[model samples]
Target chain A: MTDIKTLETASSPEKLNRVVIEPVTRVEGHGKVTLLLDDNNQVQQARLHIVEFRGFEKFIQGRPYWELPVLVQRLCGICPVSHHLAAAKAVDQLVGVDQLTPTAEKVRRLMHYGQTLQSHALHFFHLSSPDLLFGYDDAVAHRNIIGVLQDYPETAKQGVLLRKYGQEVIRLTAGKRIHGTGAIPGGVNKNLNQKEREFLLQDIDQMIEWGKTALELSISLFEKNLPNSRDFATNETNMLSLCREDGGLDIYHGGLRARRPDGSLIIDGIDYRDYEDYIHEQVKPWTYMKFPYLVAQGREEGTYRVGPLARINNCDFIDTPLAEKARLHFRAFADEGLVQSTLAYHWARMIELLHCTEAIRDLLNDPDISGTELITKGNMREKGIGVIEAPRGSLFHHYEIDEGGLVTRANLIVSTTNNNRAMNESIRRVAIDELNGRELTEPLLNQIEVAIRAYDPCLSCATHALGKMPLEVQLVDAEGHTVDRLYKNANGDVSLCKIEA
Target chain B: MIRHFTLDGKKIPFREGQTIMEAAQDAGIYIPHLCYNPEFVPHGSCRVCTVKANGRIVASCTTPATEEMQVENETEELQGNRRELLQMLFVEGNHVCPGCEKSGACQLQAVAYYTGMLAPEFTYFYPMRTVDSSHPDVAIDYNRCILCELCVRASRDEDGKNIFSIDGRGINTHLTVNSASGKLGDTDFDVHDKAAQVCPVGAILPKHEGYNIPIGQRLYDRKPISVVGDVADHQEE
Candidate 1:
């Protein structure tokens, strides 16, 4: 860590002349963005590197088939429930159970919605809310969760409570907030008790109102800064998500649906179990993460945006009335075209948050949640694939089991990995548009982060873990001499350091 | 007339040849023991049942219940030592409770909880162990073996199969099958063998039975191990 005195002597917020930026805030896990510049200060190349490596795929081998669901939760702390449920679905196939009992399905769905609600609430209020509530160019010190709590206490309070409510739902359904063993092979192990159902029902209405309030806040903020955000980090890319049989937005279970930037279907109603037939992961030597693209479009053009933006853009309609209305308005705002603005991710996320609340309420009202039937037994299968729309984007869990019921192979394409190329493109656009031929400023550096933050990538879950990831930035001339360097420790404190020639 | 021993300030009546654990069990006092099944001869291999007898730490299951003996079982210092003992047992084996089908029902996990061992303090051994699933009706997951020798005792004394034994000594110590092929499937041991049901952990599991009991409904889920006791203790009159 660079000392305060050394940092003060080297540079300050008012006069940041270095090319590097601070570590990204509000995102899960560690990542780095590098922009290669020419002598003319032109952005030559931009890349988002996943620096951590947790080889979960290799480690999960030889484990019992029944343990897959719980074991996979070790992949991500932010969205363990998503991984848990995905693995559960895959193990369900391994058990040769095509469908879960109504009670089991509803319990799992309720758990997933709670996960989506809490995850989105956390990212919106705690992580990205600070940047949005305070202008992007606001003082770095005052542009964080603490800053939001001090200035917008009511909004922050709602965010905390909404997140708490979601976690409570998870606890009652899944057994714990994180690394829960709720979902098991073939089906869930337990059903929602009447008491648990009522406990969640008590807050459904307030959570819905808060969800709407958050949606409104995001919309107003986006609209207020329409001009600046419209083209900021905007890249017209293809989008992908899971949609119901009737093309309704279904985050938990559905066939794969993908669309071009023009709202034309690239692929629709394809089984996600056959995902490898259409999708291929392209490996680059620079990072641990793999870039996934459509097989037909190839790597460069096939790279698509996912998560809130993609799900909202690709789905025909949202099932919930309130979220459907909001989705319609969102479409109207986009002139019935896909919303290409990166900043619109916040809006789409809140819209889904509202949808999750409605879905949660509906599920709680259903008597099946309290039904006794929880598990289904069937013949065992060899290969199993499970896909779900995680809080970030589409997540896939594929596994192969031996005759004796031990996992032989495991392959996981986490949500963030699907958006790898899109995140790089977002950073590239920001660097080209904002930082070209200019001295590095704190706010300009933050613009690069804001673009990537829109996708809400969990790099830890995507590439895996390695403790703290300190963000570092370096600049070199055409001849590649160390011109300048900046460093941001894990605490998000940025300091300029002189590279001794 | 019954002789008595003072255990943690409580007068525990005992028979002449009874061990402290036997006396404790008879008096409705639960002393956490993994390898001391009352159905077989007691082998104090696992030190989880260590109690202070006359100011000296000793295995309560093997120590004879002497008249006018003073024993301290539930002191804070004893509990802490027991926690350390349980932690060693945890770190020494690949006891992934979440992944194990026997998690909720296993006496090892139950006793660990009763002793307040939330997380292991020692560095994980991560020792490479075997899983013998060749048996049609039973499987042996050596990774979860605690070297308690309950299966060894149960097979020899009750089942009369002599199908299991401990192989290595010290840190390398592990349960070994007595078959020529060194696999449970090759042995004459059946799923109905007393050895099959005697493992304190997930070491010996019946094939095709995976998580039969839901987590909340498992043996120790509703109550701590002290209240429920081990299967042998529960079966004992």
Candidate 2:
């Protein structure tokens, strides 16, 4: 990861200008970024710092594994399903339940897809839409759900419907929206009935149609507003995702596939069980969250992206017809099927919504959905890994167990954290492009926020914050080497250099 | 004496220590529950039962039948009671039902509509109470408390810790953290305690979560509790 330092400017410059963006607002959790500009007013180096700690993994050590789905779900409400499913999948792996019958798989997939739809809808409509539809210069108060509703009632209603449909799917499958109990080791506890299946099918059809309209509206709005055509895009050769043998769109279940921007699949069909072989987590003292990178590729060059944009970019084809059409439309915006701009995540998410709906419809219509024998019994034996594509990105849940099937060790790689490196890069690029030589207006700052929100990053899942009050940020320069540091107390402050080091 | 019934066309037997819901799970016939935990004593406050024992709608959690009896859990009248009971629970407390963390996983909220509870006919009694943040990890906000007793029971029975007790009486009777300081942090209580994890309402919240999961994705945001059914069935195979 430190190899990027070669790209850093020499600190021996006669003078340097330092710009600090502190406590980026409207986001759920706390994060900060500091940019060091040379006397020439060009961004010399950028550092992203997450400043909070709650210790979720540590807290869950002695607790019963059964409580994990509910407990971990509280990690982040934005993507509770990611934690819920991760916990369930981990427990399942620990228990060595291999045979996930068709019904159980369908139910789990439905719940997973439901979360993806709702989370993506929230990101595209409520969070990022304000900048695209109403412009970032709008007042802060009017830049939320209310503004979106008042400005674009039709779009807002579609968002509400789309989100509602997803929530309903989750509820039906899991018993509640946020932290449900349906997901278990062998199979989901809940099974869809004919009536519920019909309802979901009908709702999914409507969502697909509504999603198309929303996509058209988004494209028109983007075209009309035409967010500055600056080259805020980064083509980091490291891109990783879950893919099938045929390289089709794989979300709920697949193997890890690392590919280059040039479309060559490097590590295809990486057994999730052997995740430790390719990925390793680095713990920084400054943040409670751990940064994971492709071990084989090494840190600096292994700057892979995830979520809708990465998934779309890496996939060979989308299965559902309507979604395939939207995928094609998305491809039209990118060069060589690579969407480098973070702003395109919205479009990619919208396409994913359609695909989820279509995929859900297919799953619901499957004859095996209502089967009685959902769970396949198995005794605790070997360690295993469960990988699924969370709404935000690829989620990996790995567990090791003793003879009794109790989890001895668990390592979770959430979707949000998977995109952390890319998110930091995206934020740095957008900040440099938007803030360089420009007045620090609220609108311009909001635009930078808009770019970050484009990834729909869940900072809470990234960093667990207990009752500790939010921290303050400071910008300091050691000679010409500028550093951004966040402090809980003045004496205990950790420098930005430590992060890169 | 063992009790027997036909649930969803399958005949199942119930043991002495088992509630109808537990018996159903053991027999592979899931019955929905919100306040009844095998780890804790059953609190049949939600009344989500269409259970007809000898031709009368009774709360299955509290009802113990004798001899060979016919019970109808899927009837319209039983569904009506379940719905009405849900409405009562909703209106009695500060169940902003939509924004609650337990919305999706909440038994009370989901069972209400699953049994055809369309709207609350009664007036909502939004009580005001203080948030007991004395504990470092757990938070207890009495306002959102539904008097489910899951916390009280779990604290006493499962953890063998009587750290929580009910104060006042009737509608005024609310769960109080059993510490001299009256704050969660002041007590030995942590989120890992059964008292904290078993809260069916948003009354007891973990300090770590705030705006992490949005309101839309909260528990009970999806289908009703009847669908998720019993917890015993969710155990690892």
**DockQ of every predicted complex:** 0.44, 0.03
Docking class of 1: acceptable
Task: Please identify model 1 stretches exceeding 4 Å from their true place.
Answer: A1-23, A462-501, B98-105, B207-218, B231-237
Per-residue lDDT value at B82 in model 1? 86
Clashing pairs in 1: none
lDDT measured at residue A409 in model 1 versus the true structure, 0 to 100: 93
lDDT of 2: 0.66
DockQ of 1: 0.44
Q: What range of 10 consecutive residues in model 1 chain A has the weakest lDDT sum?
A: A1-10
Q: After superposition, how far is residue B45 of candidate 1 from its true place, in Å?
A: 1.2
Residue A251: error of model 2 in Å? 1.2
Output the TM-score of candidate 2.
0.64
DockQ for candidate 2, C-alpha atoms: 0.03
Q: lDDT per residue, candidate 1, B104-159, as tens digits?
A: 78888888889888878899999998777777778888999888888888899889
Interface RMSD of each: 2.5, 11.6
